[model samples]
Target chain A: GAGVSQSPSNKVTEKGKDVELRCDPISGHTALYWYRQSLGQGLEFLIYFQGNSAPDKSGLPSDRFSAERTGGSVSTLTIQRTQQEDSAVYLCASSRDMSSGANVLTFGAGSRLTVL
Target chain B: AQSVTQPDIHITVSEGASLELRCNYSYGATPYLFWYVQSPGQGLQLLLKYFSGDTLVQGIKGFEAEFKRSQSSFNLRKPSVHWSDAAEYFCAAWRSNTGKLIFGQGTTLQVKP
Candidate 1:
């Protein structure tokens, strides 16, 4: 894809139900990031992946949230036992490379998750 | 801990009026500053960034921001704002050690025609 792409533009899941959001990063990009934007709040970093290395998961809100990147191309964010507070816009972004200075991120349209 | 502060939660300006949005950051080391705009139902779009070089950095849409190290401020400005410029603006600062960004709550801009 020419730019970062995310699937399921919108999803509504009942509380306690599990959900999965997918992201397809730009081709040849080596760095991918996930963020969450709550209502009237700034974007919060969720995870970051640099190539095939272990991802930076420090920002995951809790153990219920996890993500995986396969083949260094597509990634999936999984939320187990979703809560109403989990509702937010999930954003995915990709950069050419992490080590490169002046790396501007290209972002996807984002997926709006609503936990009822 | 690194943090970004956008004092104004909402700002209103008439069309063709000059605009300034205040942003302050606290970081132990030199900061990587950025401003991004988000229209309703849209993802964030980077307006500009400041890493080094001249204090004043120019960005798209005739917007510019000046990095003031002394005051820990990076204020965004535009000579004249159009109706299309109405959007939510966010200021962010990245931690050099971890490359993580701490963003401000955001400022909603309203352009009156």
Candidate 2:
């Protein structure tokens, strides 16, 4: 794709329900990251996937939040038993490479999830 | 605690006037700085970045920012504001030790015609 792409731009779900957000990064980007932006708050890092190395899940808020990248091109973020606090804009970003020590990223429009 | 701060939550400026948005970061050593803009219901777009070299950095859409080491600030500036430039701006910093970018609360710019 020409840029980072995301699915389900707007999602409304009842509490305790599960939801999945998908992200398709740029054609050759080797690094993918997930971020959460709440109303009136700064973006919070959620997770990162770099090439075939193990994912860095240090930032996930809880065990219910998990993500997977299959075939190293597309990624999916899943939330189990969603809560109101999970209502936020989930942003996906991809970088050409992080080994150069620069985090130059291109982002998707984001999935706006509203858990009621 | 290390943090990023944007003092002004919202700012209003008349169209064609100069604009400045302030950002500050607290850290023992200087870190990579970046500015991004987010229009209504859109994804964030990178404006510019400062790592090393000259203090003044030029960005897209006629935007520029200066990094001040002493004041721990990276303020975004535009010589002339446009109505279309009205959007939410973010300031972020990254350090290898932290391994993640820390962002400020954001400043919402309102351009009045």
Candidate 3:
């Protein structure tokens, strides 16, 4: 794709329900990231994927938050037993390479999740 | 740890007025800095970045930012504000060794004609 792509631009789920958000990064990009943006709050780093290395999950808020990238092209963020506080926009970004020094990130139209 | 701070939560400017947005970062070493703009319902668009050399970096949409290493600041500026420039602006920092970016609370710009 010409740019990063995310699915289901908006989602509304009951509290405690699980939700899945998808992201498709640009072709040939080796670095991907996930972030969450809450109302009036800054973007929070969630996870990073670089090649086949173990993902950097240091920013995951809790055990309920998990993500996976398949074939190094598409990624999915899954939230189990979602809470009302989880209502936010989930953003996905990708870069050409980790060592490229051109750390310019290409972002996708985020998925707005509303946990009611 | 790397962190960014955008002091002005909201800024209002009349069309054609010059604009400036302040940003500060905390990092042990020199860090890569970036500014991004987000229009309603759209993805973040990179405005500019400061990596090395030339304190002033030019970006798209007639935006520029200067890196003040001494003050640990990288402020975004535009010579003239436009109605389309009303958007949420974010400042971010990342360690060159690690590409993870730490973003600051965004500054919302409102342009009035």
Candidate 4:
């Protein structure tokens, strides 16, 4: 694709259920990022993956939140036993290697998750 | 700890009016600073970024931001704002070692005719 892509543009799930959101980053981008944005709120960094190095899970809000990238191309963010507080628009973005200064990122439309 | 701050929660500017959106950051070492704008039902688009060199950076749609290292601020500005410019604006800073991009609460810009 010409731009970053995210699946399940809108997802509604029960409070206790589990859901998975997917992201397909632009070709050749080495840096991928996940962020959560609640209504009227700013983006909250969730995680970052760069190349084959260790992924940064420091921003995950809790143990139930996890993510993994496959083949350094696609990624998935999973939330288990989701809570109402977990409802937010999950955004995915990709950028060239950080070594490339400024680290400008291209963003996806985002997947909106709703917990009921 | 590093943090990005956008003090204004909401701002309103009439069409053709000049505008300036404030952004500030606190970090130990120099970091990458960025401005992103999110339109309703749309994703965030990068407005501009400052890593080093020139303090004044020009961005798309006639938007520009000046990085004031002394004040720890990178404020977005425009000579004249259009109605289409109304959107949610976010300021963020990325720390190289941690690869963490911290964002502010954001400011909602309302354009009135």
Provide a comma-separated list of chain B TM-scores, one per candidate: 0.97, 0.98, 0.96, 0.98
* Candidate achieving the largest DockQ: 3
Residue A23 in candidate 1 has what lDDT? 95
Tell me model 3's lDDT, rounded to 2 decimals. 0.92
Worst 10 residues of 4 chain B by lDDT: B93-102
**Root-mean-square deviation (CA) per prediction:** 1.2, 1.5, 1.1, 1.1
Model 4 residue B11 lDDT?
Answer: 99
lDDT (C-alpha) at residue A27 in model 2: 90
Q: What is the C-alpha lDDT profile of model 1 across B1-113, one tens digit per residue?
A: 67789999999999999999999998887778899999988888999999899999999999999999999999999999999999999998875456566789899999999
lDDT of 1 at A41: 85
Docking class of 4: high
Question: How do the residues B1-113 of candidate 3 rate in per-residue lDDT, one tens digit apiece?
Answer: 57899999999999999999999999998888999999988889999988899999999999999999999999999999999999999999988576688899999999999
Segments in model 4 whose C-alpha atoms lie over 4 Å from true places: A52-54
Query: Residue pairs in steric clash, candidate 1?
Result: none
Which stretches of candidate 2 lie above 4 Å from their native place? none
Candidate 3: tens digits of C-alpha lDDT, residues A1-115:
9999999899999999999999999999988899999998989999998864534788999999999988888999999999999999999999988887768889999999999
Q: Which 10-residue window of candidate 2 chain B scores lowest in summed lDDT? A: B94-103
By TM-score, the better pick of 1 and 2 is: 1
Q: Please list all clashing residue pairs in model 3, or write none if there are none.
A: none
